[model samples]
Target: MEHIEPVISVKGLSFRYRMSETVILNDISFDIFPGELVGIVGASGSGKSTLCLCLKGLIPHAIHGEMNGDIWVLGQNTREVPTEKLAVDVGMVFQDPESQIIGLTVIEDLAFGPENLEHPPEEILNRMLPILDKVKLQGFLNRETYKMSGGQKQRLAIANALMMQPKVLILDEPTSELDPIGKEEVYSTILELKKNGVTVVLVDHAIEEMAEIADRILVIEEGKLKYDDTPKNHFQSPEKFLEKGWLRIPQIAEALHALKGKDLLSEKYVTPFEEEAISTLSAWLGRESNVQFTVD
Candidate 1:
């Protein structure tokens, strides 16, 4: 087997704001490989956003604070590299889409990053064409940026980041403020990015959505690294998380777990989606055909 290098690596990372005794992050360490979609979850104030800032070279560079340990992005130390340079390889989308927008129109917004990089107009147009389509905003080129729906604004923010052609994209609660339809729009774009091989680190409270798309889930609790495992494993014992208010289990997994507690399920099953739940339940029912069952 070939060894693949991690696109992002953090070693013994710890941090706290200057003049503050409270530690925002404590001895956190992890590696994210190429083309992986990893979800970071925890209760609010778990330092998830701070971690995102660290990954993007904002913590030690732009934000003033005491920092320990090292973070390497594409093998370059984030501490050593300038944030502007890091922005080329690492893109970030914040909780509010409007915060990242700077252009009056969609095209202007998309061109902002590359334009600053001094790319020619023709080259900028070339870059925007494909990304516009990727985010499903090709038809909204001339549209006013402020007039877009919540979902559209978020997609535009994503496309703007893609204009930089970053190798790693970190999204912090991108769907928190959106309607259901808006959330789905952002989710679809994220899945599309994964398919295209862009490594993503997402911080979100939508556990069910994360279960569906995340290759691995990293749970943080009170400035500590709690769990780093696949969705199935991380969510298998939802009680442990629910009891502490760390995360919400996917509905299917929660239901399956409840059934298992009553001995109705012969084995523990963690289902993140309806289709998988259907298949697993059908198989179990087939084996229990001889046993009579009553539905309350």
Candidate 2:
């Protein structure tokens, strides 16, 4: 079997609306490899959505903007490629699932992409049934999309994207609309996608959750790419990105920060699980038995 290069690559990418002199994205560059789950994060209006649009070929193609630099998906330059063609190489799931969903029913929506691509009916069905199961929507395939919960609707949007079988999958705040249970379901789904060797790019404000799933994390600030590193390193220096208010700080970091001034809180507990956080703090406090806890 032949090896494939990165599914998505962006270099010196910058964008701004025609009427505005201010740039919404500036000198952003990143690469997403096959089977890697990468997270993009920043504060509100930090150009997260604009960057996503650019990556999806919607910035210059569908939206009017002054765009600069090169974005390559599946080895094709996005500047010269139409979204319809890029759709085969890259799939984008927006924050609002309702905005992306158009089919009256779930199965119809899932089939829309494959149908447009002129995929044979048998082949489409071959791929469809397994994907529905992958997303845990097996029984809901024929259900009306409007009747589905926010999380289920989001899954439908993802199914629509997956129907394309693109090399790269981009999700913008896939869990922002979900309740706690919904968030869990979506995250589990994402993990399944990663296991299937799909390149994943996630744009979200939920830092801790992303950390749990992402192999690499990139922080954008005022339209500029700032920090690019593994989740472990990003959490080690959350303050650097946290200062800009665009990066998501890990939950344990937040808990530790909240318990500042106590020696027990200074120990590292990077995982997302609450049990790990408690256990680490307990051990740290136990080690300092000689030092009594004094309420200030």
Candidate 3:
């Protein structure tokens, strides 16, 4: 079998702000392969955002900080490469959509990155048109960005990032401030991106969303990496995460765990999706009492 190289690699990474004595990130390390959607979860002040910055080459370069260890994205050392150069390969969407939004209109915002890179007008249009449709903002091309809703702005932020044609994208709490509909809109966009083979690194407190979409999950605690495992494994033992105040397991997993404790569910059955959970439970119940249960 041939080995696949990771698109992003971090080794013994550590950092402390210039004037601060406290270490913001302890010796952290991980690898992200191409076309993977990795979710990062942690309590507030746990250095999740800091790690995103590092992946984007913002740490120790744009931010004043003392750092140790190395992070390589697409074979380029983050410390050695300028952020502008890194931006071409790794695009990042911040917690606040407004912070990254620079253009007055949707078209201008989507074109900003490529425009700065001096892409030809025709090439920029080719890139922008498809991304606008991909992000479901095709009709908002001439709309004033400031007048858009929260979800529209978030999707716009993602569309803007996509304009760079980056291979890897990192999002820091991209849906944190949106309403339920808005959150769903952003989540749909993320799933679409993953389906199209974009490597995504997402940091968010939306544990349910992570469970539903992430290929793998990383748990960060107090500037240290505590857990890196599949969502099924992490949520299988909800107590472990709940005990440490790290995450809330998806509701389906929570119910399944309780059923398993009562010896009503087999250890082999573990999932975060409601439809899967319902099917598993319905089959088990039917075998026990000839009951027929179906999802509506």
Q: Please give the CA lDDT of all the candidate structures.
A: 0.87, 0.80, 0.86
- Provide the global lDDT of candidate 1 against the true structure: 0.87
Tens digit of per-residue lDDT, candidate 3, span 1-296: 98999999999999998899999899999999999999999888999999998999999799988899999999999999999889998999988898899999998888888988899989998888878887678788899999998778888888888888778999999887778776777788889889989999999888887888999999998899989999888887777876776577787888887877787776556578766777788777675433354422
- Clashing residue pairs in candidate 3 are none
Q: Which ten residues in a row have the lowest lDDT in candidate 2?
A: 287-296
**lDDT per residue (tens digit) for residues 10-117 in model 1:** 999999988889999999999999999999998888899999999999989989899999999999999999999999889999778898999999989988899899
TM-scores for candidates 1 onward, in order: 0.90, 0.85, 0.91
What does candidate 3 score on TM? 0.91
Which candidate order results from sorting by TM-score in descending order?
3, 1, 2
What's the C-alpha lDDT at position 205 in model 2? 72
**lDDT by residue for model 2 (118-199), tens:** 8888898888888888667898877998898887888778778888877788999988877777677778878887988888
Off by over 4 Å in 1: 284-296
lDDT of 1 at 231: 88
In candidate 3, position 41 carries an lDDT of: 90
